[model samples]
Target: MTARNQGGCDGEHVCRIVDRAGEHFPGSRGKGLTARTQEVLDDLGVVDEVLHFGFRHLPHRRYLDGDQVAEADPHAQRTPTPDRPYDGGLLIPQWRIERILRTRLAEHGVRVELAAGLAEFSQSANGVHAVLDTGERVAARYMVGCDGGRSTVRKALGVRFEGETKEQAMLLGDVELSGLEPDAWYQWTVRGRGFLALCPFRHERSWQLQAVPFSDLGAEGSFPEPSLPYFRRIVDDLAGGNGIRLSKASWLSTYRVNVRMADRFRVGRVLLAGDAAHVHPPAGGLGMNTGIQDAYNLGWKLAMVCSGARQSLLDSYQEERLPVAAWTLGVSAEGLPRVAERFVNGGSTDIADGAPSDGQQLELGYPASSLSVGGDAESGPRAGDRAPDAPCVDSSGTLRRLFDAFRGPHFTLLGFGESCAGPLRDVGTAQRGLVKPVWVGAPGSGADLVDVEGHARTAYGVTGDTLVLVRPDGYLALRAPGASRTAVRDYLDRVGVSRSA
Candidate 1:
């Protein structure tokens, strides 16, 4: 793979890349990943890698304004239980996440070629041809621009990036700190001044520092360059005394808050994702998570299309993701001013407090996409909703989660209750490798596996005869009542899945 910047998490220009190893940062400004995103990472087989790197299960978030302090609700820390694996969220460092992704890609025999910038590119009916800054030419059937907000690919495509950049800028960096507990995140605000926050990093004596200047300070001709002295001065002004000391600094940069999105995610065969597609403030910590989901939403469709599926499958990428990007932009933009106002007034700046439940991205779906079909309009998880996970027993009597059955890159046919068994079997037989059928029911009900406590049934909101066809990306493609193998096959056929396969 050709990358415009250096390889690994240290790529400066890339939004996903992190410069430090063994350094910890808030996964999402302390809100963490929703159980849904965690499930997706687990499906990709990288969740374990992140855990192996030692993750901090933050118990509480503390906000400090001068002498006043407020603790977040203890219930806010609740995550999904084991039985409902898709329900909770996690907190892990971006660096560790980057390492896990890089490791996984390497295991697949893919290598990143760093500093190979895309200078120019064009596409024809056959494929896209790209020219690198090194005078190299490469061709591919599709291209995705994951570059940051100032993307050359998006610029070259002439996709209008719509939104505005705030007049104020925020400063972020990793620095060495003293006399602070690493267990809880710390935020300090000064009335009519500004705000400063320090969250524990992965390594000892390290913290991720974030500071937003007051309007008066920000309005000054130009922002000062980020340096040790400048950071120390700000810290002294905002978080002085209390035995806090900012000894040294590593990475530092000034960023203007922007809420912009590409008018079109795709121009011909070239597509955009991440900051290249949308840019927004970091209030809800939605930037990185949104980008990751964008790739996840597009990856399987891209694979199917490249493997001879209908070109229309690629169209769903933008259809499904663009709306999501727009929603996220709106959420972050709405939350930005609140957060900024809180900072200036020395009030609660907890982003989670201002963020909506959908900010976790669990509720996001492609309900109106062309790929979704056949489901009850008013009951249960209809087509295009995320497939929830519940506990189940496998054929070997081994206890497993519904996610275990939906783990791989194949469609899953879930037969809820005994009445749909024959149709599920028939669909499984006809689809074979293209789909995996699992019979869900009470234990000893002669089904493939028992829903046992009926968690699966309850979670799926299924009773009597119901069949849910889950797409490879873990979204409901079809949810039909009664036994109808035709319905299953028709839905598969619509998505270009061969029944005979």
Candidate 2:
């Protein structure tokens, strides 16, 4: 392919595509964007290039139009969702994102060079240098360390990862089983000795199982790899050797739990994300999700900073994400021990509280920083509110997600129907660069039209007609039930946005 300027309606800077296309590129998974997020990227003009590779091809069909596309294909089944219950372990979205990334990154002009391991990394005031296993050195303006708990970059930076490793070990394996309860996750315990959890993956033929042995029960004081016999023994302990039978096994691995967080996410131009910065026991299946969110949060900020945002804007990344990671690590640390205790003390089978905790749920707000909009005066979870997606209507009389129009780098103002918030709509859109107003509800609904379901209403805590300004990272900036342009302007200026408009 040739270098080309793919201009947009806005102008030449909208997007550009210039790179090699086809087979030369290699694709690596385990961390990539999903189809839904990819569509968002396309809409934002963040990626404007395509290069397909061998054994990597688009599915040629959309999966989200209420269709079960994955059920029809063997390969597609590898990506599973909560909608489909499995007798085995569930295939979380993080894994699905990985599958898509393996294909999409190459399509988006990322040259994936694999099989070559990293040997060393060196950093200077100029930039960071990575020496690959093949003796190739790659240099970049900045290097992000997304490489799991044992980060090579973090080591190269001479930073020590602070945390304790657990002696309790878990044996995990994916197996094919039948005659088991279908469509739900299963957990059973042997009354203070061991506990077993079974989750279904994508295919009916496979499932992931985790078995935790009680103290000093194993030969080496660690849960070792389980053969067919050993697995059956644990199954019998949990299920009394009935109700489920297993035959085939896929992948088996052993993991030692650890809870740790790095001192600083940023060391000069090199930064850390995901497990590299914080590692926690996998109680809520959040290790991967948190890591992915870290990448997503950092991805756009890095892009904006590199493209020309205030340098202070870049510093806010650590300020914003570190708290979230800290909260996640704390919650996980609190949860796993409780879970272990419950299993040991007769397997109570009580569910962990799924309701969002103050620290667990909110889109951590940054105070005393360039990105913060609201002042530190507010109490409760107001300072750090996760931006809520609502059912809303567009100007053309079509229903749309509140998050849809609010995409890209801008503050989104959701004008809840016209009655109560009609005045807010006018005030919000009039603010220009600082605010982008979007009207929700039908054409003639009163300014305070509230059509959200119970779940959304409960999540957002919306009482009546309101104006909710969502920040770029999907956090509530300023919220008011009534319209007030003066209030909006004051908040924007506080956040460092110019108020010339």
Clashes of each: 4, 12
> Scored by CA lDDT, what does every candidate get?
0.72, 0.54
lDDT of model 1 at position 429: 77
lDDT of 2 at 59: 27
Q: Write the per-residue lDDT of candidate 1 for residues 1-501, one digit (tens) a residue.
A: 222221222112221121211343333232256666777888898877655543335544544656646765433655665344544445555655765787887776554455566778888876677777668777667778877789888999999999988776778787887877776667777787677777775444567788875643546324678898888888887777767888877667777778899999888777898888999877667777887888888777766565556777788889899998888888888887787776666666664555656656777898899889975545567899888888778767898888888887788999887778787878777877668998887877877777878888777777668888898889999888757767887776776756442
Off by over 4 Å in 2: 1-94, 101-107, 202-204, 215-221, 351-370, 376-383, 413-469, 478-501
> What lDDT does model 1 reach?
0.72
Candidate 2, residue 372: how far the Cα is off, in Å: 1.8
Q: Write model 2 residue lDDT over 391-443, tens digit each, in one string.
A: 54445545555556667666677665355355555555566654676655543
Model 2 residue 255 lDDT score? 73
* TM-scores, all models, native as reference: 0.89, 0.69
Report residue 114 deviation for candidate 2 (angstroms): 2.5
The positional error of residue 299 in candidate 2, measured at the CA in angstroms, is 1.6
